[model samples]
Target: MKQLTFLLLVLLLPSCSVEDDSAPLFIEPIYVNNPTFKLKLDIIYVLPNEKYAKSKYNIDESKYLDYLNGCFFNRHDIGIVLGESRTLVNPELYDLKDDRGNESAIFERETKGTCKPDRLNMYIIPRTNTIAIAGLGVTQRTLITDEFLFKTTSPHEIGHSLGLHHLDVDGNIMSRVKPYLRKEFNSEQVSELIQQIITINNR
Candidate 1:
């Protein structure tokens, strides 16, 4: 009887061990394939007229697009074609006090009148001093930036559009502070962005 009991216990232990080993561990999904999506650039100017504002900035849209392609999209295998290019003149957006006013609120108000549902909207503004911002995965995805913006600013804002948040580490595209020179996205960020792009495409 004792020997039979010991044999039964031994048999149960192996099954219990196997069950423990088979339990699922919660792990995030990682994507290895490159995902592509459409991106639009909307150069917004708060001035008397669009032509006057263009002269003030003197920005070459095509050249800027090419630079962005090299720095971000092409490197990540994310194909971003130039979409709608428009100039907006909003006194309210321009008049809003930078230090006292809210950038997000200003963006929301301006984009509500001009946002397109199909593509990412990048709003480039020329100002002496203003805050730059980006909407994270919102339907009215928008980026509000100034003429003096760093080269990495656009890509960083676009990363936010793809649902990426700021990282505390330096030399990362998603760093919280400025002087962001790093243009590379980490694997996890890429995977998460890919997932977001997939969901957006599916919809």
Candidate 2:
């Protein structure tokens, strides 16, 4: 009887060890090596009129582009080329109200007839000095961002354009809360993004 009891305990220990090994030990941030694909991003500043041309909330196009390029390089070894920039006067887009949920209508209004299919369009609008929605990604590879948001918001929105969604976990590039605090993508996210880029290039 004593021998049988010892055998049963040894069998249970292996099962318990197997269960423990099932869980992952770590989830390291993902990074790509020698990325082959590159994306051209066009930054568009949407001003209400000439009066607000020197508004403090307006983003410096060159500086913002440099910031985005550095951020992407550090994360996934991806390259983002700074494309053309233009200031458009559209009062309707500047003073648009967000009555509808998701703010898709405002994004549509701001990007309609202004986007190019070959490049990504980033529109910085003077909706408010405060960061309301931070950024909105629309079809045609266009993004409408708030003027007062930080440069980190650019990559966050760009991530959305690449088909990545917000993650529930903190300290991730795709987290919904204070994404500016995190700037790195996990291993899985980087892999998915690379695959997405490959698919787009093939198409």
Candidate 3:
């Protein structure tokens, strides 16, 4: 009887460690061998009339780019190239034609074409390659967070550019909101997105 009780306790030990369903998931890191994917950003900022170039974040665009690159590179081993003088289709592009036919009016405004198996998405806005951080109403101060070098909003878009979708798992770069990313994509998502990118690019 004593031995049976001990065995029962041991069996219940793992269950005791089960966390609450509402608790956030703490994910492990995924270290990739430098991204094999070569990415380009034809960024545009139509927010409040093409203000990405003049926004406070743009004071150091390269710094922002580095942060963006690091977030993705650590995930699927991807590199980013900022395209010059490219005309972005603008968020309004979809209103003109909903080829992909996404129901998200907000997403349509925020994202462009996801070409490779829908992995590589183009952000069309403002006409110059950039993402602008703007606030609606009194939410101006809400964007400050450790998840990004500057603002979390830009990285969200960059995550899509790197083939990451908004996974509810906390800490992953593609999380819908903050902490926007626990910093980078974990091993599972990295593999999933890489295969998606490869599938998309090979097409």
Best candidate, lDDT:
2
> Which lDDT tens digits does candidate 3 get at residues 18-132?
1111233333434455457755444333333354343522435466556556544645576555554232334443232242232233443344342223223333332122222
lDDT of 1 by residue, 102-150 (tens): 6555666676868655566666655433432322123435454454333
Error of 3 at 124 (Å): 7.4
Q: Tens-digit lDDT track for model 2 on 1-203?
A: 64334321111000000011122223233345444666667777777788765353556666665566555543566666676776667766665444324355666765778876666677776536213455665543444445423444555566677676666354565555444356566777788767765665454
Which runs in model 2 stand beyond 4 Å of their true positions?
1-35, 50-58, 97-102, 127-131, 140-149, 178-180, 198-203
TM-score, model 1 to reference: 0.67
Query: What is the lDDT, from 0 to 100, of the residue 118 in candidate 1?
Result: 55
Cα distance off (Å), candidate 3, residue 58: 4.1
Off by over 4 Å in 1: 1-37, 46-56, 98-101, 129-140
Give the candidate order by descending lDDT.
2, 1, 3
Every candidate's lDDT: 0.51, 0.54, 0.38
- lDDT for 191 (candidate 1): 76
Residue pairs with backbone overlap in model 3? 35-77, 35-78, 43-129, 43-130, 44-130, 46-126, 171-182
